[model samples]
Target: MIWKTIKVNFHRLGSPPTFYRLAEVLAPWLWGGFAVCAAIGLYQALYVVPPDYQQSDSFRILYIHVPSAWQAMAGYVVMTILAVIALVWRIRTVEIMAMAGAPIGAAFTFICLATGSLWGRPMWGTWWAWDARLTSMLVLLFIYLGIMGLYAAFEDRRKGARVACILILVGIVNIPIIHFSVEWWTTLHQGATIRLFSGESTLHESMMPPLVWMTIAVKLMFGAALLDRARNDLLDQDRRKGWVQSRLGETA
Candidate 1:
C-alpha cells in the first residue's frame, strides 16, 4: 500500500498543473500571514518592548539576530532533507527545493552574522570575534554557498543535485558542533535564548515579547519565501511538460 501510494504520487509528481494550483492556494495565505505578522512583530519590538539593561538599545538587534540565526540553520536543515529525498527518490521537485533553499539559507546566515557583529560592537567591544560559535556559523554560510555552487557545476543537473546533496549531508555535522561549542568550550558566545529547561531567561521580560513575536514573524517570512521559491523552481523545471503548458494556457 505504501509503495503503491508512492508510485501514484510519483506519477503525478511532474504535473505542473496540480503543483501550480497548490501554489496558487498557498501564495495568498503565505503573503497575507507575512504582512500581518511582520507589522505586529515590528511594532511589538520597536515601540512596545523596553530596553535591555546591559546593552540598552543594542539588545534590540537580538530581535533580528537570533531569529535569523535560527532560520538560517533551519533552512539548511530543510535543504539537506530535500537533498536527501532527491538523491533517494530522484525527485526533480525535491532537488528544486534544495536548490531554492540554499540562497535563502545563505541570506539568513548573512543577516545573522551582520546583526551579530553590530550587536557585538556595542556589547562586547569588538565587531568581530574568532569564537567557536561565530566561526562555525561562518562556516555554515560557506556551506550554503558551496552547495549552491555545486548545484550549478555539473552539466547534468541531476548529477549536480546528487553531489550537492551529499555535500549537505556531510556539512551538517558542523551544525551540532556549533550549537554545543559554547557549552563544551569556554567561548564568547552566549548561552541559549528560549531555554525551557532553565527556570528563567537571562534576558529581561520586557524585551522577551518583541523578541518572541519577531521570531514568529521571521519563521512566517521564511515559509512564504520557501513556498514562492519552490513554486518558481517547479515552473522552470516543468516548462517542457504538457501539464505546465496546459496551465500556462489556462492562466492566459
Candidate 2:
C-alpha cells in the first residue's frame, strides 16, 4: 500500500505541469512568510535584544552571522538529500530541487563567511583565520560553486546533472565533520551550544526567540527563491510539452 502511494505520487511528480503549478502556489506563501518573519526577527535582534556583556555592541553580528551559517549548512544538506533521491529514483523533480538549491545555498554560504569575517575582526582580533570550522565552511562554499559550474558548463543537462549529483554525494561527508570539527579538533571556531532546541542551549529568553525567528525567515527566503527557480527550470525543460503551450496560450 505504501509503495503504491509512493509510485502514484512520483507519477504526478514526473509531470512538469503538476510540479510547476505546485511551485506557483507555494512561491507566494514562502516569500510572504520570509518578509513577515524577517521584520519581527530584525526588530527583536536589533532593538529589543540587549548587547552581550562580554562582546558588547559587536555581538549584533550574531543575528546575521549565526542564521546565515545555519542556513548554509541546512541548504547543503537539503541539496545533498535531493541529489541522492534524484540519482536513486531518477526523479526529474528531485533533480530540479537540487538545482534550485545550488545558488541559494551558495548565497547563504557566502553570507556566513562574510559576516564571520566581520565578527571575527572584533572578537578574535583578526579578519580571517583558516581554522578547521572556517576551512570546512570555505570548502562547502566551493562545493556549491562546483555544483553550479557542473550544471552550467555542460551541453547535455542529463550528463551535467549526473556529474553534479556525484559531487553533492561526495560533499555530504563534510557536513558532520564540519559540525564536530570544533569539538573533535583544536580549532579557533567555537562549538555550537544551541541547535534548534538542543539540550546545550543556554541563550537567554530575549535572544532565543529572535534567533529562531531569523532562522525561519532565512528558510522562507530560500523556499521562495527555490520555487521561483524551480518553476523557471521546469518551464525550460518542458517548453515543448502541450501543457506549457496551453499555459502560454491561456495567459495570452
Candidate 3:
C-alpha cells in the first residue's frame, strides 16, 4: 500500500507544472538555509578552529576544499541519476533536470580543482601533481565539459539529451575512481578524515562543527541552485504551452 501511494505521488509530482510549483515553494527555504548555515560555518572555520600543528593556518583550506570536492562529485551522481530516469521513463522534466544539472556540476568541479591546487601549492610545494586523486578528478571535469559540449552540438534538443544521457552513464565509472584513488594508490592527498560506519574523524571538536555546517550549507546551496536552474529550463521547455502563456499574461 505504501509503495503504491509513493508511486502515485511520484508520478503526480513528475508533471512539469507540479514540479515547477514545488520548486517555487522550496527555493526560499533552500536559500535561507544556505545563508544561515554558511555564515555560521565561516565564523567557526575562521575563528574557532585552531591552527594545525604541521600545516598551521594553511590547513584551513580544507573547509573550502573538502566541501567543494564532496559537492562536485555529488552533483555528478545527481545528474547521472536524473539522466537515467530521463532515458528510461522518457520524462521531459527529468531530462531538463539532467541538462540543467550539468553546468552546476561543472562549476563545482572547477572550484574543486582550483581550490585543491591552491591548497597544494602551500603544502606540496607545487601547484599541481599527477596524483591519482587529482588526475581522476581532472578527468571528471573533462567529462563534464564533454557532456556540455555534446549537448550543445545538436540543434535538435531531444536527440542531444539522449546522447548526453548515454555519456553521463558511461562517465559514472569515474566517480568511484575519484573517491577511492587516495586509498588505492600512493598519493599526496590524505585519506578520509571522516568515517561513516564508525563515529571517527581526524578533525578536532572545534573544527568538526564548522566542517559539518559547511558541508550542509554547500548541499543546501546546491539544492537552491539546482531548483532555480530546473525552473528556468522548464520555462524554456514550455514557453509555447498554454499554461506558460497564461502565467506570462498574468504577470504582464
Task: Please report, as a residue range, the 10-residue window in candidate 1 with the lowest summed lDDT.
Answer: 13-22
* Model 3: pairs clashing at backbone N, Cα or C within 3 Å: none
The best candidate by TM-score is 3
lDDT of 1 by residue, 1-252 (tens): 999998887667545566557666887787788788778878888888877666667677788899899999888888878878888888776777778888889999999999999888868889889988899999999999999899888888778878998999999998898778788777788877677585777766767777677777787778778778878877776689887788789879
Candidate 1 residue 83 Cα shift, in angstroms, is: 2.1
Return the TM-score for candidate 1, rounded to 2 decimals.
Answer: 0.89
Model 3 lDDT tens row, 1-252: 999998998998778888888898998899999999999999999898888899889888788888988998999999999999999998877887888878888888888889888988988889899999999999998999999999889888778988999999999999999999999999888888888787687777777988899999999999999999989978987899988888889899
Give all candidates' CA lDDT scores.
Answer: 0.82, 0.88, 0.89
**TM-scores of the candidates in the order shown:** 0.89, 0.93, 0.94
Q: How high is the lDDT of residue 249 in model 2?
A: 95
**Model 2 spans with C-alpha error above 4 angstroms:** 1-10, 195-198
Name the TM-score of candidate 2: 0.93
Best by lDDT: 3
**Per-residue lDDT of candidate 2, residues 44-123 (tens digit):** 88888888899877887788888888899899988988898889988887788898899999999999999999889888
Clashes of each: 0, 0, 0
